[model samples]
Target: MNEEFVLETKGKNRLIISPNQYCFIKLPSSGIKIVQLRPDGVISLGKFGCFEVNSVLNHPYGETFEIIENKQARAIYTDAFEAGNDDEDLEEENISEAEISSKLLSTDKENKSRLDNRDVNDIGSGVQKLTSVEIELLKKDSELSNKGKGIIEKLIESHTNFNKKTVHSQEKYVKRKQQKFLKVFTIEYLSASNLLRFYTSKDFGKIHELSEESLGLMISLADVRPGGRYLVVDECLGLIVYTMMERMNLQGEIVLIHENEHANLISLKYSDYSEEEIKKFVKTINWLQFFEPDNEKIKFPIKSETEISLLTAQKRSNYYRHKRNAEITNSVIDNVKRGQFDGLIMASTLYLPKLLPKIVDKIGGSRAIVCYSNNKELLNETNHVLLNDVRVINSKILETRVRPYQSIPGKLHPLMTIRSGGGYLLWGLRVIPGDKIKATGRGNKKS
Candidate 1:
């Protein structure tokens, strides 16, 4: 009750409230929720079964909350409330008045609000009051749509903690919950306008990494032109491909590449493009693997001849070496060739390091783009290395942060929410012979 609990994210369907202070408990997204840090082992409310908060706190996040459901427990008001409600005996057993006061702080505060105090009078009829200026700010956020801004404005109008500070706090809280729950499905072939709508809507389940916002940013940064021969590697469920197709309107085909084991290719299904159209543009390069010979030519090599020569030179009698060498050589040859790419765009963690050099080489004097996570140390190092190379020009790191507005009774505040493992973009155009520059330094005498 008096203790502080930091929320921890588990990989799956679990959120741990406090690790150091109390028992671990399984938390359903919605249920009769109960938390009692005091270690008497049970917190009880009528209809809802008891919960031991300390019992589950010790376990890691993402661990399932396992509670035995009581079948014979008679319903008080509804079965839904029964799931989260605690035993009625705890109210009976409590002795000290002060002990109960702290435990009820959050609940008591909630009860004072009109959302809790008033009975429902048609959900839609509730009036919203917010200033025009505040509404405009939310509208400009890129993360919010017209409807979303309207909702925030309504909260502000209602005067529910509507100040700037409280609004941001509420936004963060809501944003975190949205990310966790909304990112559960894949959206395919979404148009730029529609994609924006979907992101602001927050009804898509869990937003994918290649969600519309990411794609829109990609489109803007890439500066896609019709005639460019682009090399692409996207681990984000072909969301990149959809962007290229919609925006680039290419004269030349796009070469979409990936690591051999990448499962994203299996998920690529577009309503607009036929299988043949997809095949015509995409060339799959299976790393260190061979396929039965086919009549159709693959622009991307299954293995390069230079790689074969390297393997022969090494004289190591190992299958792995031969295969690995071939993949490397093919990628290298592809990257340095001018015709291989007009520009490069990649969104792969494993392929970024090895693939980027080859892409820069192949792009010759074209553009190269690489997306990475902010936590990645290698991206910074890679940018420094590329900048030092004379053939690389205009290297930059770009990041875009999103904050959405939720329509609720309280003021909108940003929750501590940002999609984990996203937010760094390394980009630049390539340089060839004519693009070279010389630098002058002051003459120095030998010391």
Candidate 2:
């Protein structure tokens, strides 16, 4: 009776954007917004304007649409952002090759004459007509009145030195302004990676500023496969688990150990996965249960015969329910204690030095152990500990960064700002040593 309809991307309508499922809309400003569209619903894009959900139903994602009069929308080519695009976009989303590279080389022409920025300081050296306080007021007014385009135009007109800037500089300034003022958006399919991007744009700290590369790398290092058991300790708001679920593809079992009484799976709350599938695919246990599964459960299970003889018919049925639950709980505890898990993948703030030893044995031999943290020192200490323990070999810390650049021919160069703080990972392999590792400290000392 409690069924949650998860939007499936596998059916004939996989390409079609349907109603009543969580969708991530990509604003022209590069901001992402999530919504569950209803049949006759109207969603507002704030200063970008509002439109009816049904107006864009059945359309494939990644196509840009302009909001016309009377809340209407039609196909439009967005050339404003064609100059600089990253390969990550081509890999993350499902955009065709021609679409992204259509006009990529248009900006490759020889350098143009530009203005000399003799005075571009923080203190208004006459670059801007509005003061800091005045600009704040202007923003508030524009946001409240839903008039961003006018405000942007007014600001550009107010700039005393706009004409003096170089052609390249002027284009950069306008592109930045249009990014904030343009009232346009593209509908994006909610893939796991896209969902991570949505949260990253909204708040980088929420997901530890996780990069697509790092997340994908962790899955690879762990070597996650169908039917393999995984032990996960995710403190990144269940993002790690959600991404893993996509890789598991509803085949393997993910035993999630939550730090709280209830699993902090807010990211998965809006997922299209059914409650039944989630229940079957993901098994949960508290830290106490995972660290110590034998105390209350190591003893004999609830005596069904004793409870049945003392209780009424209704009470006996209740007893059976309790008995079944007890059995399931013990089963999970037994499996974890038996060391059958395929891998140990963790992304928590807990001290790795003290935590690694406790959970390392859970993973099967010749398996992988991948630990992630935003701070490098955490992994540094983890790496040191893993190398000392002969069971874990090839321990090292690795960081991933996705750099973007201007793709025009002859002008290929790195962008001013690149992705920062995707996080560091401590990767190693688990081994079962047949003999204790011993070394002789000769006059040369141990190598």
Candidate 3:
């Protein structure tokens, strides 16, 4: 119903960059900026460069673009994106040992080789001859390949200790310089994982410090699918909702019950889902309305058919709009009363021990109920509460840790620095409290 929601898209290709849609640009400085492409508009990346949005509208995502001195963008292959490209560029200077050698420059490869960085004084020994203005001039030179090899070659030639440094140190130096003056950027699709990463880098606390790996694991454990109906309570700023929508892939229905008077799902705007899709799949209800629909009904002005006929065209249109909305609200309440949702997922800061009993019944028997929190103690208390409650079965706390390793050959090991905490998850299944169970676990112990 908002003007921001449009029925038609500029392009049908999801992989290709489309105009008027939100996409992320990964800058040469390792920073990301989200932008909405407008027709014939220019995209500025500050010191890196600027280009027309139409220049990349038809191109596929993940392709890198370099800014020429003329302020135009050209698609080019970067060393990071394409393997062996760095080696090929550096091979002429005879310093192309291997791109993988850079990772071991710190502390990993001294056991295997004698060429370590012990004698390398990168900070003081090597002095760069090119000034800031001269470097800018080189970036604008249209004669170069626009692949940034020219600038790097110049930098290596200008350094006094270019040959004194080992292959590892040399590569690291070039890589650092490349990140600064390449004037390059890549466009990405902005999927759920990418969205989570953007938030993690910008404001981790805003999303309760939830990691992508943990979020994916929770969704998998919940058995989210295209056709299943689901219930959710999110306090992570529509993060769970967006990820759930990604898993649902524009199918089925998700009923989100919020504790606040209005849902602040501002991040969902960049999800690229049309208004029609969101309106159809995601049904939002107030906490009170969900718990007591009769007492907190979605109210509307009552007008008889005869009374409506006496009004003008504008009043008649307004009346129908309000009538349709109220009808939809009442219908959602009626359906929720039918109960038996496929699953219930929560990522709120509320007290779970008392909250679970009230909403767990909405979830169907044998279905999953997953809760996420920044503190493990909250889930631990919930686990204790559900341990004896017959309404739930197999309640337990879960945590998924993803250890990332440095992706360089011959230096393949986990990175010393990593993300410490991604929070915890509590999992359980809905069950009939009155039902008598013959056995609860292995060995068939009767309850």
Q: Write the per-residue lDDT of candidate 1 for residues 75-132, one digit (tens) a residue.
A: 1211111111222223434222211322232243344333331343322323334455
Candidate 3: give the clashing pairs.
none
Top-scoring candidate (TM-score): 3
Question: Scored by Cα lDDT, where does model 1 land?
Answer: 0.42
Better of 1 and 2 by TM-score: 2
lDDT of 3 by residue, 331-397 (tens): 7787678788889989998899888878877889889999999899999988887776677777778
Question: How do all models score by TM-score?
Answer: 0.42, 0.76, 0.84
User: Candidate 3, which segments miss by more than 4 Å at Cα?
Assistant: 1-12, 69-71, 81-114, 122-148, 299-301, 312-318, 434-447
Candidate 2 lands at a TM-score of 0.76
Selected candidate, larger lDDT, 2 vs 3: 3
lDDT of the candidates, in the order given: 0.42, 0.71, 0.74
Q: Is candidate 2 or candidate 3 better by TM-score?
A: 3
Which residues of candidate 1, in runs, are more than 4 Å off?
A: 1-189, 192-211, 249-251, 261-263, 286-340, 351-355, 373-375, 407-421, 433-447
For candidate 1, the 10 contiguous residues with the lowest summed lDDT are 1-10
Question: How do these models rank on lDDT, best leading?
Answer: 3, 2, 1
Q: Give Cα distance to truth, residue 54, candidate 3, Å.
A: 1.7
